[model samples]
Target: MSGKGALSGTEVATHNSRASCWIIVHGKVYDVTDFLDEHPGGSKIILKYAGKDATCEYEPIHPPNAISDNLPPEKCLGPVDMGTVKRVEIKITDQEKARLGRLQLRPPLDEILNLHDFEAIAKLVMPEKAWAYYSSAADDEITHRENHAAYHRIWFRPRILRDMTHVDWSTRILGHRSSMPVYITATALGKLGHPDGELNLTRAAAKHGVIQMIPTLASCSLDDLMDAAQPGQVQFLQLYVNKDRQVTRRIVQHAEKRGIKALFITVDAPQLGRREKDMRMKFDAEDPDEVTKSGGEVDRSQGAAKAITGFIDPGLSWKDIPWFKSITKMPLILKGVQCWEDALEAYDQNLAGVVLSNHGGRQLDFARSGIEVLVEVVEKFKEKRGITFPNPRFQLFVDGGVRRATDVLKAVALGATSVGIGRPFLYAFSAYGTEGVDKALQILHDEFEMNLRLIGAQTIADVVPSMVDATNIHSHVVAVPGDRLYDSNYESMQHARLRETTRAKM
Candidate 1:
């Protein structure tokens, strides 16, 4: 096991105790005994599979490079002789059988008329843990609800069309041509929903001529996704600055070298918000004894979000911006500016642009929606710097609660150069894999064509401020009109269920 040659399963099994544990991952054996306690998910999960193949358990939640990134090179014992290893039997429960049946019953892809349809189907078929992690937002989830509700207040003001027969929704983002004005925004742990994970997105985006923002925490390695890309397929990078400067530098320089079109650095999460649903799911999966293993010193219940994000540098600030600029010549844009003032600062700082976002409402509860922030940014930029919408020099992007093509048009009408859609695509692929995403993009394309004509706009440029009335966009108390599509897709929060009591038997 000392060298890089393949080691037999019997040899690895000899070091199965806590004193010197080794596990097989992707056919490689690693000594994780020293790493068990520091593992963000906790020591017990790893201990259960000590000296065994953990690839099945490890694939869904972690990025591909996680083990190599965290463990020392000396600890990587060698490649395992997988043929000689014992395979763990995975038992399917009754609940999973039921879920599989429901998955088969999903309506034909053609029947999935809108993004909401995909969400409804995914909710019924996705694993409970995946569903919780994908859907859970910050505390109270008020921001999450409001993110969608804000769009309802925006009223379209269509004018008599001069000629509606021809209309196109194609637009450019950060100077790259896109099929539509939407980019597949970054989402982590794609393998949680589908085995292919972000690769499904990469292939689909390439086929549809859509730009994808690759996530720092993607289950597939960055190089894997890049290698998967077709020649001339454009991609962007979304970075969560690492605590180690060298790690961040390597990542940034490598991305630039790999032909990344732009760098979208996430500036919202200093710490991930309290997603209670995700936390509860972690509790359900963990052993009770493991919770007390660290003597309560380390809280292992922060769930999937916190487990993967412990390396993020909380001290990230404006001071680090110059260093990022120095390392790479890629056009930089701040990804989570929530206020018009901050948007103004980004503009003043001469960055490429700023995405008026709240980290898809997963970071700060009650934070304003990207569209809401778009209106303010547009107005403030015009007032303060005398710059207007569609400024080629500095672009403004929006993301969050965007499910419809009409929503994209609205954001574009207000000021956004483009909008980013995250969960809807995640749901699409989760329900039906790559084909689901292809249909999802096609649905949007159709909607854009029809909506553009209906709104009496011929092109993306024709969608201006006068086309929509946002007079009530800021009114929080106004009862939003009942949306049957949204209502059907929305799952309300549930309280804790009472445990069943055992009765005395005769």
Candidate 2:
């Protein structure tokens, strides 16, 4: 059965039981009976589609190469004669019909004037699972709400009468030129929102000359993203270290070999957090007994994040940094540093840089926002290392709660090499696919032109620490002010709904 021409449907159907199961995905056949015990989401899901095509169920959540990468070459049973195979017919539910209606009613792309606009539209149109995974943070979501709110505490101090006829928002990120001070950061499972997935960002970034950090859990294969890039397009890799050292090493070495500019190892999330909204979804439908029979002691209630994250190594530590360095020549950066001490440690360790982020407030609930951490990181760097801001040797990057070019500029003024805009781009592509991302980038470009002139700064260098008052950045208990931008875009967390009962006869 191993690559011996097209297998007939009759032959494939014979191995449907748990004793020996075979499935078709994107035209190829695979014998997954051996893999069932190791499947992260549990074997039940795959068993549901045993002896049939699982392409529809597999496409959104798993990377394109997931099956091929995990299964041995001999397990690949070659392509099947699609004509003889019975395809799975996906029924359109009432909820999907409503979502489609909302999609039809989406605001015109030009009307999406700000980054927040894309988010507002995305909330209306995205699938519940995708929205929950993207928008939900850790328990109570305090840091999630605070990430954007913290930016509001900062007040800009615009200059007067500086020649701002030609403002340049363009800057270099880790030695690569970017058209703006913001780069599209890594967010996983792109296909949940759009079919093109991470490729939407790749194509959009290429057109706008922006940098994109590819997520380790991207639905599209790493090779697919690289193959889609235009000449000289700069992209970075965001890695979640695996339990198997050899697997992690292969990923790192492969990324470097494929011209990945830098390696931004995600230092956060040794284990995926309890994002309650995501937990509420509880994607797995199989019984506990069934799941345990496959993957030992599985907690299927944790939803999509838990389902796909079993491979992450909790044993990863500082000692592993040297091993990473030994495997590749690419510049290495820690992606989830939340405090100055860790940032300084990264510098001392002779690493490239640190991203002052708290995993977009999706990990620890009360963790400080990246922008707030930037101030502390900068202050410590100057005092402890006698280092200046935007040090070429140790670049300080920031991500989380950035919704506007003003937000990007504020981070720049406070001493960030660049800010990573994650959710807005995710929302953009989710709502409008590649075109949505294009409009979002254009909106930022327009905002950069207007706000840079308004702030009286002609270039990224003109954005200085003194240009913004961050006195209240650390004060977490200040009275809330009405922010129209945030109010318009923020989707409030909902309480569980009561079951509908039959109305009494009137």
- In order, candidate lDDTs are 0.89, 0.87
Model 1 lDDT on a 0 to 1 scale? 0.89
TM-score versus the correct structure, for each prediction: 0.96, 0.92
Work out how many backbone clashes candidate 1 has.
0
The sequence of per-residue lDDT tens digits that candidate 1 reaches over residues 398-440 is 9999999999999999989999999999999999999999999
Q: Residue 134 of model 2: what lDDT?
A: 86
- Single out the weakest 10-residue window by summed lDDT for candidate 2: 293-302
The positional error of residue 146 in candidate 2, measured at the CA in angstroms, is 1.0
lDDT of 2 by residue, 1-506 (tens): 22447898778878886789999998888999988866756678788889998998888887676787678899998888888887677889999999999999998997888888888899999998788888888888889888989998999999999898798999999999999998999999899889899999999999999999999989998999999999999999999898988989999899999999999999988877778787666543456676666554445545677656767899989999989889999999999999999999999899999999999888898999999999998998889878989789999999998888898999999999999988888899999999999999999999999999999999999999889999999999986576787777666666666656898999
Residue 410, candidate 1: alpha-carbon lDDT: 94
Against the true structure, candidate 1 reaches a TM-score of: 0.96
Q: How accurate is candidate 2 locally (lDDT)?
A: 0.87
